[model samples]
Target: MYQYDGFDQEFVRQRSAQFRDQVKRRLSGALSEAEFKPLRLMNGVYLELHAYLLRVAIPYGTLSSQQLKRLAMIGRKWDRGYGHFTTRQNIQFNWPKLEDIPDMLDSLAEVEMHAIQTSGACIRNVTADQFSGVAKDEIEDPRPWAEIIRQWSSLHPEFTFLPRKFKVSITGSSEDRAAIKVHDIGLALKKNDHGDIGFEVMVGGGQGRTPMLAQTIRDFLPKSEILPYLEAIMRVYNQFGRRDNKYKARIKILVHETGIEKLRSLVEAEYEALRASFIDLPQAEVSRIQNFFTAPPYQNLEDQEALLNQQAQQNTGFGQWLQANRTGHKQPGYAVVTISLKPIGGIPGDISSDQMDYVADLSERYGFGEIRVTHEQNLVLPDIRQDQLFDLYQDLVSQGLATANAGLISDIISCPGMDYCALATARSIPIAQALSRRFEDITSQQNIGPLKIKISGCINACGHHHVGHIGILGLERKGEEHYQLSLGGHAGFEASIGKIVGPSFKEHQIVDAVETVVQTYLDLRTEDEIFLDTYRRLGDTPFKEALYAAA
Candidate 1:
C-alpha cells in the first residue's frame, strides 16, 4: 500500500473540511436542492430511495489492515453494520446520514482513503489487476503506476467537468485481469524484443448503453512517455468528445464516430506537445514512485506439491476451495487467494466489520500484510503461502468467506440496483440473488464452466453487464421490469462487445431464458469449448434460435 505523504495528508484534510461546510449549508437549507445536488455528488454522496449512499475509493483496491479496520469502524458507527464492495473495486455505505458524510470522510482521511472523484463527471479511480505485484504472469507492478495516475488525475481542474465520466485501467500482465479493454483508456505493460518495459495503449473502450472494446491506439509506448502520452489521449477525448447526449459523451463514442486512424493521429499530435511541456515525467520521478512497490519478504521454499496434493486428497472441501480460490503467484512459495464476498446467502459483496478484521489478520498471519479488492467485488490475499493455504482455508471457511465460485455462474457482478441507486430503472440485486439461488450447486456451476453473469438495473452498466459472457440488462417497459439478454461478450485479453438476442423477457421468465441459453451452449459446444469460444466460432445464430425458438 502507498503511504500518504505530508502533502497527501494535507490534501485530504482540506478536502474533507471543504465538504463539511458544504454539508452544513445543505442541511441548514441555505443551499437549494438544485444547488446541493452537484455538490453532494462531488463528495460521493447520493440520495437513494431508502437513504443516502457514500462511495469510497480504494485506490486500485489496495488496503492496509488499518484501512480495512477504519472501513469496519465507519460501517458500524455511522450507518449500517456492513459495506457493499462494488464492481469497480469500491465500497459503498448504504445508510449514512446526509449530515455525517463529512465526518465519515474525515475518518476515511485518517486512513488515507476518501470519496473524491468516485462519482460525477470525472476520471474515476484508476483500476489495475487485483493480483498486481504478486501474480506470476506480471512483467512489473502496475499499482505504483496506477497510484501515479490517481495522484495526477485527482481533482484535476481541467477534466473535473468533462462531458461524462472517464475511467482508466492498467494491467501489468498479458492476461488482462483488470478488464482494461472495457475502460475509457486501457494500458498493458509489456517488454519488447529489446527487453525494455513499455505500455500497449488502448483507447475508446467502455461499457454502458453502448459497449465497445477499445482499439489499440499505440502498440508500443516507451516507459518514459506514459504520462505525456496519457495526457495527450485524454486531451483529444475532452476536446472532441460529444456532450449533447450523455449516452454519446464517452470517449468510446468519439472513437466510434471518428475513425481509429484519425483519433490516433490526434492523440499523437497532442502527445508531441505534452512531451515538451509540464506533463513530461522524468525517469528519476518514475523510479522514485516505483520504488515504493517493493516485493514482500519471503523465505525461499521449494515445491510443496506432494504435501498439498496429500492434504487435498484427505479433505474434499479443501480440495474444492483450492481448485477455485488458489491461483499461481510469481514467488516460488506464495499463491494468490480470492476470498469470495459472495457467501452462500449473504449479499453479493457486503463485508462485516468482524470479517474485515478477520481478513486483515489472515493477510498478516498467512500472506503478506497486504490486501486487494477485485473488480468482481471480492477480497484477495495475494501472497498466501501454499503451506499455509489449508489452515487459511479453514479459517476463511469458518468466517463464511470461502465460497469456491470464482468465475463461475454464481459469482455474479451486480450493482446495488433500484434498492439503493437513484439512476436505476429496475431492481438488479434481487434478480441476481434469485438467479444465484437457482444455480447454487458447485458441480452445476463447474459443468457450466467459466461464465460471467453480470446484471445492471439500467443501461448505466454499473454492474458491467456489457462484458458478461451472459449479459442481462434490466429495463422498465410499460411499468414492468423486463430483462434484455446479450451473448458472447468478454472483457479479458480478447475483449469483444456482445450482440443482443431479440426481445426482452418478463421478470419471472429471465432465469429460464438464461438457462435456455446455457443449454444451447452446452449442446453446440465442442468437447473443450467454453461459451465464448463456441459463440466466437459459430456466431450468434444458434443462441438466438434457442432463445426465440418458441417466441
Candidate 2:
C-alpha cells in the first residue's frame, strides 16, 4: 500500500482535469469519435460489444479498505451494481455510460486509484504476486520494484506510445504466482550465492496468436540495475520492434524474429550506455520505496495448528474453506485467506457492490484493513489471524464470497468474452460457469486436486488460457461457439504453454469434454499426482483420445 505523495496527487488531479475536458469535447462534438477513441483508450475506457467498459488498475493487485469501498461506490453509482475482475488483477466497470467515465476517474483519483495504463498500446499495469510480502517463502517483497516501474512508466514521454502494448510482472517467491514467464518482461526476485538480492530477468514471454515462454536474458542482475535495464529493453523494442503490422508488433515477436542472444546483446549494449549517464536509481531512493512495503505489526501469539485442527473437527464448511482457501503467512498464527469469487455457476470474478463493501469491512475488522486481487480473479485478506478464521469464513459465506475452492478444479480463471468484449470470438463466462457447475462437488474437486482451468474467448489470451493445467480457448467455428482444449500448461517456477489436444468442441459439449479429460487423468495418475503432473508425465495422448472418444 504505497500512499500517494503530493506530486502523485497533483499529477493525477491535472490528468483527471485534462481528461474531463477531452471527454467534454468529445460529447459536445468538438472532438470526433475517431479523435476521441485513442484518448478514451489511453484513460482505460473501451467501447465494448454492448456498452463502454472502464478498466481500473489495482496496482500490483493491492487495495486498502478505503480504496475497495471507493471501487464499490463507483460500481454502484456509475455502472451496474457489480464489477468484473480480470486475469490481469484489474477491475472492469462493464456498463458505464460514456459521459460518466470522467467522474468515475475523478472518484478513483481520490482513492489513489485510476484507469490509466489499463488499456491501449502503452506500458500497462505492472503486476506482482498478490501475496508478495505475506508469503512465507518469499525472498523479498516485489511490490516496491513494481511501484517503481509504475511511477517510471506512467506517461513516460519516451514510452508513451509504443508499437504494441507491454506488460511486466514480478514475483518475489520461487513459486511464480504472478506468471512472470508469460509477461513482456518478467522479473523474479532472488538472492544470489553471496546473499545479495537481484533479479532473474526474462524477456519476450507472451501469449496471443503466438505463445512463447520468456527466455532468461540475465541469470542474476543486481537489484540496483532493474530500472536502467528495463529502460534499455524498452528502448531496444521501441526502436526496432515492428510497427507495420499490429498483429506482430509486440516485443515477443521482435524477440522471436531476432534470437535471444542477439536481443540480449542489444539490451546489454543499451544498458551499458545508460548506466554511464547516471540513470540508475540511487540506493537511497530504492530504500525509500522499500520502506512502504515493510511487514505489519503482529502480536506474538502461539501457532494455531491445534486450534485449527480443533475447529476443523467441529465445522465441516469452515474446514473445507480452510483447506482450500488459505496459504501460510510469513508470521506465525496468521494466514493469507483467499476469497474465491468463482462460486459454482456464478460469474467468475464478478463481485457485487454489496459484496465489495462487506469484504472491505471484513478486511478492516479481521485482517489489516487491506485487500489483494489475485491474477486468478479472487480477493485475498493477506493478514488474517488464524484465530479468527471461523468468524471470517461465516461472514464471507453470508456474503457469497466463501467458495472453499481457491485452487480447486472449480476455481476457474476466465475473461469477459463475447458477452462483453467486442474482440472475443465466443462466450467465455457461460463456459466457465458451466464447467464450475459440472465440478460443483467439493469432494470431487478436492479429489481432482490443484487444477487450473483458464479460458479465453480468442487468441488474445486475456484469460491466460495458455498457462492453465487444462486450458480452454473459445473460438467461433462456422457460426457457433466452440472450445479447443489444451493440456499440461502450467504457470509456476517451471512455466510451460499448453498444447492443443484435438478439435474444438461445441458449446454444449465442452463441459463433458473437460470431464472426460479429467477422468482420464484420474484413472492414469499415480498416487498424489495432480492434473498437471499427470499430464506432464503422460503427455496429451491419453487426454486427447478420451476427449475425442465420445465424438
Candidate 3:
C-alpha cells in the first residue's frame, strides 16, 4: 500500500478542515441545500433518501490493518454499525449524520484515507485488479500506475468538473479481473514484441442507460506517456463532451457521438501537442512510487498442497470454502483468500464493524497486514498461507463470513437500490436477498459452475447488471416492482452486454424467472459448459422461450 507522505497528509488535513468549515456554514444557515450540494459532493458526501451517505475511497482497493481498523472505528462511531463495499472497491457508510461527517473525514485522514472524488463529476477512485501484485499471471503490478493516476488526477484543476463523472480501471493480468472494458478509461499492462512494458488503452466504455464496451483507442502506448495521454483524452472530452444534458455527459457518450477513429485522431493530435510541455514523471519518481508496492518478506516455505488436502478431507465446511474462496498466488505457500460478503439471505457487500475488526485482526495474524476489496463486492486477505487455510476458515466462520459462494449465483453483486438511493426505482437489496435464498444450496451453486448475477435498482447500472451472466434490472411498472432479465452479459476479457430475454416480470415472478433461465441452461448445456458458455452457444432463443413460454 502507498503510504502518505508529508504533502499527502497535509493535503488531506486541509481538505478536512475546509469541509468542516463548509458543514458549519451550512448548519448555521449561511448556505442553502442547493448552495452546498456540489461542495458536499466534492467531499464524498451524499444526501440520500434516508440520510447522508459517506463514500471513502480505497485506492486500488488496498488497505492496511491500521486503515481497516480506522474504517471500522469510523463506521461504529459516526454512522451505522456497518459499511457497504461498493462495485468500485470503495466503502459507503449509508447512515451518517451530516454533522459528524467532518469528524469522520478527520478520522480517515489519520489513516491516509479520504472520500475525495468518490462522488461528483470528477475522476473517481482509480480501481485496479484486486490481486495486482500477487497474481501469478500478471505482467506487472498495476497498483503503482493506479497510485500514479490517483496522484495526478486528485484535484486536477482541469478535470475537476468534467461533462460527467469519469472512472479509470487498470489490470496487469490477462484474465481482466478489473473489468477494464466498462470503465471510462481502461488500461491493460502488457509487454510488446520487444519486451517493453506499455498499456493497451481503451476508451468510451460505461454502463448506465447506455451500456457499451470500451473500444481500443491505442493498441500500444508507452507506459511513460500514460499521464499525458490521459490528460489529452480528458482535454478532448472536457472541450467537446455533452454538457447541456447530464444524461449524455459521460465520455462514453462523446465516443459514441464522435466516431472512435475520429476521437482517436483528436486525442492523438492533442497528445502530440501536449507532449512538448506536459513534462512526464521522471524515472526516479516512478521508482519511488513502485517502491511502496514491493513484495513483502516471504519465508522459504514449500507449497502446502498435501496439508491442505488432508485438512479438507477432515473438514467439509473448510473444504467447501477452500474450493471456492482461494485463488492461486505467485508465492509458493501463499494464497489469495476471498472473504465473501454475500452470505445467503444477507445483504451483499455489507460488512459490520465488528466483522471488519475481526478481518483486520485475521489479516494481521495469518497473512500480511494487508486487505483488499474486490470489484465483486468481497474482501480479500491477499497473502494467507495455504497451510493456515483451515484456521483462517474457522475464524471467518466464527464471524459468519465463511460463505463459499465466490462467483456463484448466491454471490450476487447489487446496489443499495431504493432502500437508500433516491434515484432508484425499485429495491435491489431485497431482490438480491431473495435470489440468494432461492439458490442457498452450496452444492447446487457449485454444480451450476461460475455464474455472475448482477442486479441494478435502476438503469444507472450501479450493480453492473449489464455485465452479469444473468443480469436483473429492477424497475417500476404500474406502481409495482418489476424486473427485466438479460442473458449472456460478461465482464471478462471478452466483454459483452447482455440482451433482454423477454417482457419484464413482476417482483413475485422475477426469482422464478431467473430459476427458469438457470434450469434451462442446466437442461441444455453440454459437458462442463457454464451458464455463459451455454447461453452464448445456444443464444437467447431457448432461454427466452423457457422464460415466457407460459405467458
Which has the greatest TM-score?
3
The TM-score of predicted model 1 comes to 0.97
292-342 in candidate 1: lDDT tens per residue? 888878889876778889999999778778888888988887788999887
Candidate 2 residue lDDT tens string, 138-168: 9989999999989989998888789999999
TM-score-best of 2 and 3: 3
Q: Show where candidate 3 strays beyond 4 Å.
A: none
Off by over 4 Å in 2: none
Please, what is the whole-model Cα lDDT of each candidate in the order they appear? 0.87, 0.91, 0.94
Rank the candidate models, highest lDDT first.
3, 2, 1
TM-score of each: 0.97, 0.99, 0.99
Worst 10 residues of 3 by lDDT: 542-551
The Cα error of candidate 2 at residue 548, in Å, is 2.2
| Model 3 C-alpha lDDT per residue in residues 1-551, reported as the tens digit of each score | 79999999999999999999999999999999999999999989999999999999999999999999999999899877889999999999999999999999999999999999999999999999999999989999999999999999999999998999999999999789999999999999999999999999999999999999999999999999999999999999999999999999999999999999999999999999999999789999999999999999988778998899899899878888889999999999989999999999999999999999999999999988999999999999999888888889998999999999998889999999999998999999999999999999998999998999999999999999999999999999888998989989999789999999889999889999999999999999999999999988989999888877777
Better of 1 and 2 by TM-score: 2
Candidates by TM-score, descending order? 3, 2, 1
- Residue 293 lDDT, candidate 1, scale 0-100: 88
Runs in model 1 deviating more than 4 A are none
